[model samples]
Target: MLNRKFGYVFLLALLASSAAVGAEYKGPLDVPAKVNTKFAQSNRLTAVAKAGNALVAVGPRGHILVSENSGQSWEQVPVPVSSDLVAVRFVNATHGWAVGHDGVVLHTADAGKSWVKQLDGKQAAAVAEKSFKKAVAEGSEQAKKSQDLVTRFVEEGADKPFLDVLFLNEKEGFVVGAFNNAFRTQDGGKTWEPLFWQIDNPQSYHLYALATHAGELYAAGERGLLLHWDRQRQYFSAITSPYQGSFFGLLDTGKELIAYGLRGNVYATADGAKTWRKIDTPAPDSVVGGALLGAHYALVTVGGRILLNKSDGSGFDVIPASSPMQYASVAAASDHSLVAAGARGVRVETIRDQAIQEK
Candidate 1:
C-alpha cells in the first residue's frame, strides 16, 4: 500500500520516485486516434473539472487545455496571460474561478471559452512593506531579532497568502489562506469582505482544500487539521484525524463523502463528514485533488497518478488506469467519465463506456 506519511522514509521515496519518467503502470486508458502529443511533458496540471463532455485541465503559467468528446482530441484555448493557475472550479459551463500562488485569481464566465484576470499579485506587495516598517520601528536588539521575523513575513507570506477557494454559487463564496487570510463574498464574487481575527505574531497556513455539501462548508490543511462551519458554530473547529498528512481533495458522494490527502490517506463518511473510515490504496502519491461525477464515483489524482476510484454505494475501488499520470490531478465529466491529466500537458481518457475491471 502507498501510504507515505510526511516523516516516513518510505513515503518520501514514493513521492520522489513516482514522478520519474519511467514509473510502470498497468491500468486502463484510452489510446487516442490523434493525441495531442505536445501535452505529455507538462508539469502544469493543478486541477481538473468536468464540463459538458469535455474535461478541462488547468495548470501553471496560464495553461488551459480542453478536450471534448471525452479526451479523444484536445485543443488549447488561448489564455490571456502566462499566470500560474493553481486551481479552477466551474459552477456550470461558465462562471468559475481559478486561484493560485501570489494573489493571482482568474475568472471565466463563458465556460472557459474565455477568461479574464480578476485579481493580481500586487495585493501582496503590502505584506513586505508592512514587515519592513515594523522592523525599522524596533531598531535595537529586539529589532535585530525582528529581522528574522520580518524576513519570514516578507518571503513566506506570513502577512497574507491565500490557498484554496470555494464558491457556493456565483453570488456567494469564500477564500481562506495563510496569515489568517479569510474572505467571504455575497455578490457572486463581485466583491469580498475580510473575515479576520487579530493575533499576536500571526503566522501562515495554506488552506489546502475546500468543499461544500448539504448547506455547510469544510476546509482542511496542514497539521492534520479539519475545520467545518455549519449552522451552529459558523466558525471553524479544530478536528483531529487519524493521519497527519495534508488533506487536499474532497468529494460529497451524497451517499458518502470522501476526503483524501498526501500519499494515499482517504477518510470516508457515510452520514456526511461526521465519522470517517480509512481505506487502503496504492502508493502515497499525494492525491492533491479530485472531482465527483454523478454519485458514488469520482476521478482522483494520487501521487502523480490518476485513478477512477469507484463507489458501489458503500465501498470504493481504485479502478486502475493505463499509464502513470504525467501530472498529479484529474477530473471527470458530469457523467463520471474519467479524464486523467498532468504535466508536460498529458491527458488520457476513460469514459463510462469503458469497464472498470478492464484487463
Candidate 2:
C-alpha cells in the first residue's frame, strides 16, 4: 500500500534513489530535462497552479507545461534541471518558482516559458549548517539542537527533496520539503536563508504543503504536523492538530482553513487554529489537493475522487470524475473549470451538479 503521507512520485523517487546507493551515476540534479513534444499527452503531472490567466503544471523530469486557454492546450518549456518537480507556485503572471527532488528550486521570470535553477539540496545543507553554527556560537537556547540537526544534514549530503513552494509575492517566498528542510528568500530566488532552526519541528517531519490564510503563513506535513508563522516570535509555531495522521495539503476557504490528509481525514478551523471541527468526507482515501472556486471549493483525492463544498466549508459532496484517475493537485482555471495534475497527466474537467465532465 502507498503511504498516504507522501505523494506517489515522491515515494517512488526516494526508493529509486535508495536502490542506486553506491552506483557511480549522474543524477537528475546534474542533468537537464529533455524536451518532449508529447509531454502534454504523456507526462505524469503532479501539481497545477494558476499564473494569472495561464495554468501551469509540473511533474517528473522537470516537465513544466503552460496553458493559456484554460487548460485547453499546453506547451512544454525549457528547464535547467531534470529533477522531478513536485510543486509549483506563481506570485503573479511573470514570476514563479518550482521545487522538487534533489531539493532543487527553479525560478522563472518570463512566466513558465523559461526557468533557472536556484537553491538545491547541496546548497541548502550548507546554508543550514552555517546558520545553525552561528546560532550556536551566539548561545541561543535552541541553537545546540539545531546545530546537531544541521550536522546530520551536512553528513547526509544532497538527497533531500523539496515538496512544496509558496510565494507571498514577487520578492518573498518559502520552499519546504522532506526532513524538515525549508528556506526563505527575500529577493525572490537570489538568496535563501535556512529555516531549519526557525521552525519548531524537533522530530524533523517532512513538510508537504504550504498555504497562507488571512496573512498568516502555514505549513502542513507528516503526522498531522501543522505550523503557522509567528512574526512576533520569529519562527513557526505548532498548531494543535486534530488528527494524528499525516496531512498532505492545506486549503484556505476564505471563511475557514481546511487540512486534509490520510484516510480521508479532513478538519476545518474558522478560529485561526485555536480549535478544529472534523468535516465528514465521502471516501476514506487521502485528500491530496484542493482549490477554491468562486463560491465553492474542489478537493481531489488519491483514489480519483473529487469533493466539493461551499466557500464557508460546509455542504460537502462527492463530485465523481467521468474517468477516475489518481490526482495529486488541482487548480481553478479562468473558465471556472478544474485543472487536475495526477498520475496520468494534466486533465481538464468541469463540474456539473455532482459529476465532473472531462474536457
Which residue segments of model 1 deviate by more than 4 Å? 1-43, 124-162, 178-180, 196-203, 231-234, 299-304, 308-316, 334-336, 351-359
Clashing pairs in 2: none
Models 1 onward score TM values of 0.70, 0.89
Give the root-mean-square deviation of each candidate in angstroms. Answer: 14.0, 9.4
What is candidate 1's local distance difference test score? 0.59
The count of residue-pair clashes in candidate 2 stands at: 0
Name the lDDT of candidate 2: 0.86
**lDDT of each residue in 186-279, candidate 1, tens digit only:** 8876555544321112233456677876666777777566767654634565555666777776777665556788776777766546677887
Worst 10 residues of 1 by lDDT: 26-35
Top-TM-score structure, candidate number: 2
Worst 10 residues of 2 by lDDT: 350-359
User: Top model by lDDT, which number?
Assistant: 2
- Relative to the true structure, candidate 2 has a C-alpha RMSD (angstroms) of 9.4
Error of 1 at 146 (Å): 17
